[model samples]
Target: MQNFGLCLVIKQELKPIPLQNVVVEANIVDMIAEVTISQIYKNIEKDTIEALYKFPIYEAAAICEFEAEIGGQRKVKGIVKESKEAAKEYTEEVQKGHGAYLLESESKDIFQCSVGNITSGQTVVIKITYVTELNHDSESENIRFVLPTNIAPRYGSSEYSSSSNEGKILNPDVVSYSSKANYYLDLTVTCRMTSTIQNIESPSHKISTEMNIDENPKISKITLTEQITYLEKIFILVVKSKDLDQPRAFVEYNPETQTNCIISYNKKTFIYTALTSQEILTIQQVARVKSTNISTNTWINTLEAFRHDLQLPGKIEDIDTKEELECQLVLFFVSCKQQNGKDYSVQSIKTARFAIACHINLYSKIRPQDINNKNVYPDLYNAITGKIKILTKSGFGESRGADAFTESEIQLIVNHPAMQTDSPKGLLRRIFWHNAFEFALRGGEHYDLKIQHFVKRKDGGIDVIFYQSKCNQIRLSNSNPKSEIISISPNENIIKDYELYFTKRPPQCDDAFYLQSCNQAEVEFTGYWYKSAHVGRNSLNKFMNEIALVTGINCDDRKFSNHSGRKTFVQYSKSRGISDNDVMSVSRHKNPHSLSYYERPKTVLQQNTLTQINDIIYKKRVVTNEAKNQSTSFTAALEFYKGSISENCKFKALAYLNYHIAYYIIENNISPLPLSEKPRVPFQEIKDSQNIQLDEDCIKKFLQGNTFNNCNITFNMNQ
Candidate 1:
């Protein structure tokens, strides 16, 4: 079999100069950094040029400011208007011959900037400012800041590209390594540390640093060296603090809002508590990072902000009593078995702010200072819930949908060698999960598929239970936000696959799957086995990419992911004319809007409407035009003239003659033009005698079964 391949070709040869210079400044304070980027552009072309450029940034960063400077003067500050209003104002200003610039978020991490009416020899400077918290390297306790230099190409279905702001990122030619743009960058950083600073350095570029020893020794200035010219890879700066690794807690109050907040954390869990509106608001968020080192890393996993707010108890003295905390439920209870096989280890869940917040009511009870003097929870159960009520409201959280896979692609992935296993434990695990996914199992629900959740009946039927995120912990009712149970017959392929898998499954790890041994010797190995549900999602994502590569599917991580399977199930079911309710029953999607997102318009070839219409038109045309051989000689005569002709010259000559011949046939209802009025290409001709002679020669050659070269044929000039 041929190797799967994907090729991206730069189709446009006209590379216009888009940028002249870029200037960047960053100021770091504690965990937050504010960055400003300024880009200069000059239009040398005689006509006015409207420049549209897509830029990248840290996904977590919030854009706070924008401005445009025309001809080194006339500054126009950007307003955070609605997208439509911004576009309208930009168009109106540009129509009035005034320079305008509009900046809009393309995605969480990408932004599009449009500069209008840069007249000849005019320079325009556009600046953008944003703020983001610095990411911490857990092992080294160093804070890292990165500025993205290149936009990674995104891939998806045609409908996905058209419906979303993905066109710029999906363009093949706008790559990180493209040298067509001659823009260079000048970057400077000013660092201010709360604790004593150990050092500040850049891994991506050489830097010159200046220390303010006479002033605050903790403050420093750094700039990239002159040799670094291209903004291709990320510009990464790391700052190490001497004692920031210790467990810490702090409280702050905002007088304007009359809000008091306490933040406390060690390493695993972060607690945030806010007192506002006469209510105590507490959130327990977790952080998951794949890399333990400060070295190479791409993704920082963050969970959604889980918020819980309740009215304060009637008496301040009642706060410490357990009776007042009756309504609260510990939402998460994650347990991982250690390799030693005897102990059960508590696992910390990674939510958005796990390392940040502390509820005042709970903090006073646990007295973290008395326990460990750090924010790290002594027990997972304690960290999960502390007199906190489970928030009752249910609604859709913001999440981008993944593209669905084609049927063929799905089959290829399911049939891939990696999925086919004979080992007892591995086989059973793979088969069960693969079948589950085929049956429309969602990523979130996968965690609920434990051994207890599976029930095999005596009559060869099996029922598997799973839970949706909203109703998983605290249930409002049985049917309102229901837990789903999917049943499969014994004779079904899914059952057989599961049976085969379980028979050969390994004995050591009874969990659905076990983590493969780490390749590095020095790395601390977690002996705990993984359930299909608890595996790092990134691992599954990596597997999805591998499947794409092996299946010859044209997809990237952004387009095809673990969620694609669920989407595929929904789309395929809907395409088969299944009602939304029926499909939702199995899929457990509570909202119709969630399911409707997959109902994108079908591709052109899949529409069939246009093809059917064309087919009917062609058939009718065939019936009316009974004389099928009407243009036989004209085609042959054109072929004769085209022999040994230069392609460009032939195209020009043949196009002129063919159009005139077509016109004559349509208007005069003739088979061929008469010899007296021979239709010929421009700068070429055949006189009456020449046409007759050419016909006689063609007939003779046909009779003799002889081929004639272009030299054997003769043409009369326009004279």
Candidate 2:
């Protein structure tokens, strides 16, 4: 009875400030998904407090909506404003002691929320909504959705000079993951698609799925099996659909105008998406306007000519046999302003055609009609023995700028003992490495060449084939003839080295370059070739490092990879003051932008123009002093001195002029070098001038001024 009476006066305290709950709901469409997150923050402490929460989502997500509720009753919609204004408003509201909340972006994938002025026994709820595109892997046709949870503490300067959209990234709530509050998350997902769902799964979180229909699934729902306690890892889900392996087209028709259009291919092929409809119409309109001077047919012919001049890879053959279907396909592509949803240069198309022909024979179902009607334009004469062939060499990594080979480094490698004693392999390696450095050949291009691709010019030079790389094919054209190489070898016997390597060259294979054994009996070495460009690159780097160590050179700081050869060429050209355009010609870089990557930054002392400017400025400052305490200016004094000098002593006069300039530089503190602090002049040579007169007093007057206050200066004549 006493306890019951005491309960009548009990006070209601606030909750212990834990994140009471979290709810994540997602609605996924064909290529886009919209997500909403609800978080409940209850202040369990007896005193009023503010809560700060930092979280992460998908990088591409666009946050479009935010709202907050106080004490489960009062709700206010969030207004989007400029980052600074929003921050200011939030601060003002919080200071007034009104319950206020602010949500802001920290990075592409991260965000922060601050809720202020929660009274005792009060709870706050924050609701955030965002949308993001679902990533689809074209090669696999699998849809991936990732909800990031791991938000690493970003390291950067805390001070921001100005306010911008990125200003929110500097929020105080953006603390390190270790210091973040313990939070629980609950996730649910709903996805609908026109295509049949084959598999739905999560790689980062344990989840359960429910389908609307057991068979021929189209709609599905997924949920995490348990609430996540750690926001330190990601939640990933993948949805794979059936018929994804088959090439499919999406056709939408507008009944209002009876207009039908093909939008895309499995949302992966980008050919039609490369150009906008308006842009395509503009091109056609320009062509139409030009056709007024000629016939419409003539304009069409002109377009065909322009396309032909581009040296596009495929051929225009008799699609007339299946005329209607082919016409429709071509019109569809033209209207879409895309070929295969990708822009393929003339060269890549030929490569693709050649590749197709090479494998056409592998299929048993291939028919005469199929061969004749197939889109392989200019038919391959014979893939194996043809002049034009698609050669395949594999490599995956891009060239990362490593080290530039110095002239001394190249010479050291050229003279390594292994080049002479290690038989055919060593000799071959030496020649290959030298030529690669001089010519700046990319690893893949060099590895792909064959003997036929190299021509021994009559003028004791070599001509090698070069391909402007493309995705599908090695496109060939008469315009892309062999690049001529003038011999710039270190050794005088480079021609002899090349001749010897050719003599020891392994028996001919489809590939131009092959590895041969020093001993002819080694069958395994007879036709050894690199499987990929990466393998050859690694081998060359290893060989160079080994040689460098043997030569007592430090290779630790430098990365002597295959790209080093290219970088070395650029560096050498720059040192010789070669123009960027001229360097691009030898490097075959399509533009100056691509060439800039190879250009190294210049050192302060290497700036010759700046050095010249400094010399001129300091010389003028020294000359300025001559104008003071003298009847004539420095220029007038120089003129008088030059007139007094005899013809034979003219060289000495120039020396005297330079000496005075140096002396002035020392007096004015212009030169930092201690040796430059004094004037350099030969006094005996000046005295020996027979045509001129000079004495110790005259010399002293010229250098340090006369002792007399107002003496008219005169040269002492030799009488």
Candidate 3:
């Protein structure tokens, strides 16, 4: 009666605060947490009045349960329904003068609860329950559990607030003003961990803890030191445990839903580990069979690539379901490409599958039973067998490794006009070529070569120490040294070439082995031959094309490339009868089979075999002297143009003429022009013709079958 009289006395001056008290209870098992909050409200007004309150909660928490108790006797259970339908029902009930409770989300991290048709002096209780996974602190091994208790006042226009209808709810005119009402908060947290709990602390408020260390699964209870505290800030609880890195798994079964949810925490990431020991062993067995023996980094990178290809989220938890995992795997297998923008090779695809399978086994909730079930992931299984296996059988997207350079081709490249070592460009070209060949360097390996990597031996030889390579990813030099030491003999000309190039290296250049070539005249004057800028990868990769252009070796085939040097080294070693072990040591190949792929018959043997096969098949058809002597007109034309034009120009002119004549015969469906009908424009007339310009435009016209006017030349068979 005293409280009612006091409320009535205050009602004339100001509205009573509806929120009376809040009690929070939380239970944590391993990394998963379940929290329940109860908020009490009282209506002190005379007539029926609505009570509304806004609250904050963890953004990641899933609200699983809600209930309301009105007038301390009637109970109402909340059901998850569409927001609009729920709102409509609540509004209809309120309009009928009946009590209605409505709880809705205001934002991701905020919620609103409204109790309508509350009689004077009536009490209402609201309960909300949610579950979330605790976050792992990146700075330490502690697990963090956060419960937001306060919603700070927003300063800007409420219309722009993230919550829907926030402007009407938070309007200053509609909200009744009152002094800061005295409210009390009570919180208790119970933690159960697989490992022993080392410590428990709270940063937001003072907390007292009760620990039980001797339990098999250690238990701890935490409570606020002050029994009644204001809801002014967020509450935070941090738990540190012994053996935190050890893998742990927990399973929760819902009897009504007839479903199970598993949570596994291992190595700072969450995964589902509901399998028995035997099932885990079975997964390991399958992993061994499908594994590509790649490094851990390579496996991780392959999984990342698969995720990127499928446009999936990076977090494993988001894609841990069976359907999502299966769909992503199928898409990745079908559409993923290599770094070169080409379809992945059969072996590479298999490796990717292996990596993805391992990732699923390690991080996803898709159980082994689901994976092994034929009907569950049919498309994924079919993709693995039909697409990948068919590709393997057909040898689709397989690389026919680069062709090796022959002895004569190598000689041509070394002696070509552009290979002169007098200029900076020429010297760089020479050094790059020799280093790639002599060291069996793969493409892009020379880009990181440094002067410090080339160590001079006491015997006047040089040792090229590779700190890292494709096989040796970790650059640890001590304890488990994987660096390859390649020795260059003192007698090799490449040693002298290296010495000369380094002698002219500029002082401003860094430790990079390859330097940009500068102007020849500038190099001579400044005595600094190369620029300080490091040679780009484009220049290094184009060296083979440059060599091919100048020497005309395999220029038409275009089969030789930067990787040709490594292939050449292997083939050259085999031709010299070098043992497999010796060759593998220099090539840094772990498998002899890899080296055998580069082995082919010697050039002489290949030619001889082809000739022998042809002789046996066709019986060596003999040629008549008339057929052999069919070059009379060609010789006469060459002699006719002699001393009139340069030899190079004369050859080019005759070649162009022959090509056009052949094209004309094909286009007209006529026989070749007879020797007697060949046009013989005198050299003096060709030289004196003003219309016959030997420029690029004239050459283009000639190639296009344009005729010369003053020279009296026409490709007309009838004339």
Whole-model lDDT values for every prediction: 0.53, 0.54, 0.67
TM-score of every prediction relative to native: 0.32, 0.31, 0.40
Which structure is stronger by TM-score: 2 or 3? 3
Best by TM-score: 3
Instruction: At residue 168, give the lDDT of candidate 2.
Output: 39
Instruction: Looking at model 3, report the run of 10 residues with the lowest lDDT sum.
Output: 1-10
Model 1, 301-389: lDDT tens per residue? Answer: 11111111233333221345443332121222222112363322111222311332222223445333222222443343354432121
lDDT of 2 by residue, 153-240 (tens): 2212223323222223432222222235566567789987768777899887689999865553788999888765544444678998
Ranking by TM-score: 3, 1, 2
Q: List the lowest-lDDT window of 10 residues for candidate 1.
A: 1-10
| Model 3, span 28-141: residue lDDT tens | 887889988886767767787765555555556678898888799878988878989999999999999988877887666566666677788787777878887777754466
Per-prediction count of colliding residue pairs? 23, 12, 0
